[model samples]
Target: MGDVFKALADPTRRAILDELQERNGQTLFEVCTRLISRHGLTSSRQAVSQHLDVLEAAGLVRTRREGRYKFHDLDTSPLRAITDRWQLPTD
Candidate 1:
């Protein structure tokens, strides 16, 4: 999907996805902490939240609210569609 590609085009978003893959079900604060510690990204909490929003719109990220906390998870099914469309033979 166009949205998926667009969302993944950003290095920051890709890093966010990587963070999710490494550790799913992370809250916004957790995500920001890991991004800065692991990737040296000094982005603000609001900026990271906006990146999460884009990823969610593209279906790359899914979020669920548990009381006051919101946890983010990665969904790679959109990428599967792309691979399925042009799958190479194993032979």
Candidate 2:
């Protein structure tokens, strides 16, 4: 859970998650492009790639390789865990 908090602490990381939620299975290039065009982020490809690495380490993002191309997908299980941990009694 520490990793999740750490990853979520960054605005850039949060934006990356939003992008993945809006459109799953995006390559590094696509992620960077959308961040620029949609969010007005000026981060470079390497910066975005580092952000993705942190997200993946936190279990909020998953990756797949197809031939030479790599794709990124969002995983919401960590978030579900957070909600489940704090859910109130339903009675």
What are the clash counts of all predictions, listed in order?
0, 0
In order, candidate lDDTs are: 0.92, 0.92
lDDT of 1: 0.92
Report the number of the highest-TM-score candidate.
1
> For model 2, which pairs clash?
none
Residue 19 in candidate 2, Cα distance off native in Å: 0.9
Clashing pairs in 1: none
Residue-level lDDT tens digits of model 2 in 22-43: 9999999999999999899999
**Lowest summed lDDT window (length 10), candidate 2:** 80-89
